[model samples]
Target chain A: MRRMAAIIGCGAVQVGKYPDRLESELALDAVRMALLDAGIEKGQAEGIFTTPDLRGGIGLQANLLCEYLRITPKSMAEMTCGAVAAGLTVKTAVNEIMLGQIDVAVCYGAERECSIEWFKHFGSALFEPVALQPYASYGIIWAYAMSARRYMHETGAKEEHFAMAAVRNRRNARHSPVAAFKAPIAIEDVLESRNLCSPIKLLDSSASLDGAAAVVVASAEFARRVCPKPVYIMGWGQYHDNSCIIPTDRCDKSISSFVATREAAAAAFRVAGINPEDVDVAEVYAPFSPHELIIPEDIGWFEKGEMVKAIETGETEIGGKIPVNTDGGLLSRGHPWAVTPFYQTINVVRQLRGEAGENQVPDARIGLVHCEGGMMNNVFVLILGSE
Target chain B: MSKVDFAWPASRHTPSGREFWAGLKKRKLLANKCQLCGEMFFPPRLCCPACLGDRLEWFELSGKGTLYSWTEVFFAGPEFKTPFLLGLVDLAEGVGRIASRIAGAEAGELKIGMPVRFTFVDAGEDFTIYCVTPDTG
Candidate 1:
């Protein structure tokens, strides 16, 4: 018989600049907090999973993390799928527990990207040298800006529409004490911000920070014995695009609507036996403001070209039809790459447990968390429920 | 503590990639076509990405395409000037797309599906690169 997995504990540190601490140190802090939250000892964890560090020379980050925590795990693996690695790590842990290989699994991620002088260097290294380097400067922002430009042409969505997303996420961040940027912003402020790339103002981009987040997953049998309230991991799904190179090899011609997100969402919803309308809250990983407007439509929450209307009509706001990014998302909470998705998952758990004091959705029972990385190449979706 | 300055080292290319870069110096735009599948690949590849067939042949392109998308990069690496237009151009043959700096047009005036043609430009240190400009014809 197949077993079920539940998230018994979640922990995260403040999302902001932490130049004084090492990445492993930050990860260890979150892991210790998660164990305390789960009411378990270090010996209870049977497996360890971690997202790989962007900084090179860290061989087998998961094992290194285990050593730092002083816990020898029977099975450990490092996830390196860029931003989606956090969600993918959780999914892998859940599967490992469901397959009866482990009773409890811990997944965590940490990053110190903001302290690096040339963070763009790490981003540009992912591109094909001979083909894409000569044309584009080979940075992450340029890719998103190109996609935003195309999205504008297709949907007739103005720059103000993207500014709305930035303003809203920043506004929501005011409720989150751990968010990187708590100051509420206006649409004019976003529009007047410095332009990093065309149509992608500096305020529209997510700020990378040094932080860590962790979660403990356990078998349903184990959770019932020790845990009081466990957020059930109803379903999870992951998908990758045709190629990591720009202008996907497939004939999809869509610059904004990523097929991988749609596939991942569809699989998650199918496994959960639920529809998009059944979701009480959602936390989407949108590093850019334009992505905040594009991803909901791609996930089938709204129709094509209708997301802007939904945004303008207050349908996606905190008190509207479906509250999204209640923890301010990556845009305001600070995107630490691999660790960002764990924040999303933890926020969903908070909402389900009615622990999100000010940002709580009324009686939220089921929530969704989605994350993607690498020019929309990889997408991971998770569905969590209270029951 | 003190601030440190660093330079990014040059990237090494594969044998197939070396031929593609060398063609740029001679103002020759080359693509690899799979003999078995008849699929064309830009930034020429040794084996077909689709069929993985090794029977590949080199072909010259018309240097013509339409602008699929573009962005004016205000912040970039040390090697590039700020506020330059970078574009993704879809080749006319529908084989693949090319990404490069777009010249001969202002950032505001560029539009999706605008016709563009390829050109070769000399970077410092004997390195040549491919650029795209608005096709007048």
Candidate 2:
């Protein structure tokens, strides 16, 4: 049988505006913390992986980070697929462990988007397929806004319904120490915020922040030996549609619901041999509020247009049915692009280990994380379990 | 709308997208028709990224379509103006959808399925772009 991999440890540098810190320094801090948690020395890791920061496209990133972290590794790479790359980096490490190529692998992402002026150019440039660049300069919000508009059309959901997503996340953020925006916000706050795109307001968007996050993975045998609470890499699914055109099919790959999310979640649940009902908690990387509503429907947590009702009924809140984004998600917890998934993974790990503090789900056994890249074209769904 | 006030830095072209841009000068909406699968591509491409069949020919669109969805972008970075109306237009030929400026429409007036017609807008940097306007017909 092929060897199994487990997440031995994970760490995060509190996400916020760190103007003076270099991206590498932030990443190094998280890596150090993770190594300390895993009880593995820097020299023990045989491989290193990092997610790409395309907005700034840091030069020689993986190489420079390796040099700064002072680690010698047999293999290394900068995985590039936008935000989703965060989870893919860990999956790569998992593969290396399963193949017996490496005993331990470290994956991390660090970028000082808030500390730098390039923050203005962040989401806009990463989207827009090369084919569509000449057409118009559109950003992530506009791409998802098209989908949001269609969702509104189909579900008759008003702007207020969308705003609830941000409000709910902000409430959840109050309990998370790493969360950036913890102030209580009402739906009116989101509605009153300036429209970046018609359906997407500034308050509905993820904050620009500088930080880093990291995770360490090792073989099941190594994890069982040292780590007290290793979260097993249960199963994962990734779907890359990479379509720049507006989705034409109403039933599949449409503007309202993301078919890619459904397929990815389906594949993950299938591989894990678990159902949506079995998933105790979820952490989804949705940069915008509408995405939060659409994702749960696509993931089969609720039926179409049911997220709005779930919001009214407290179905997504902590102590609710699904308890999504217990760490407040990208909407409230600052999102550092490639590292968002790392934070999500760490939060899931915390939940499974019964260490999530106030945001913890009772007796949580399974957690699901969802991340998407480039206008929801590429997606990754990871299922991590604690046995 | 004799002089379109909106400005794009310059008309940029990809080698595969040259025909569609060239068609803008002739007031024609061009798409690529795949020879193998008979599928149409807009914002035209050399090969079908959707379907792998590469033998494609330039096909002109009717410049008539219905609005799929759209947004008024209020915050595009520098080099662009505020609050531009962009639309996803589904060609009346039932082939595909393309994103373009929806000219001469206010935010409060647009409907999802409203008819629109393609037109040329002089972006004033010696650049002309194909855009769509609400079709009263």
lDDT (0 to 1) per candidate: 0.81, 0.80
Q: What tens-digit string does per-residue lDDT give for candidate 1 at A159-249?
A: 9999988888888889985699998889999999999988999899998788898999999889888888888898877898765636534
Interface RMSD of 1: 3.2
Error of 1 at A299 (Å): 0.4
What lDDT tens digits, residue by residue, belong to model 2 across residues B11-74?
A: 4455666666667768887777889888766556667756877899997878999888899888
Chain A accuracy as TM-score for every candidate: 0.95, 0.92
In model 1, what are the clashing residue pairs, if there are any?
A: A135-B99, A135-B100
For residue A27, what is the lDDT in candidate 2?
81
TM-score of each: 0.94, 0.93
For this target, which candidate reaches the highest lDDT against the unseen true structure? 1
Q: What DockQ values do the models have?
A: 0.42, 0.48
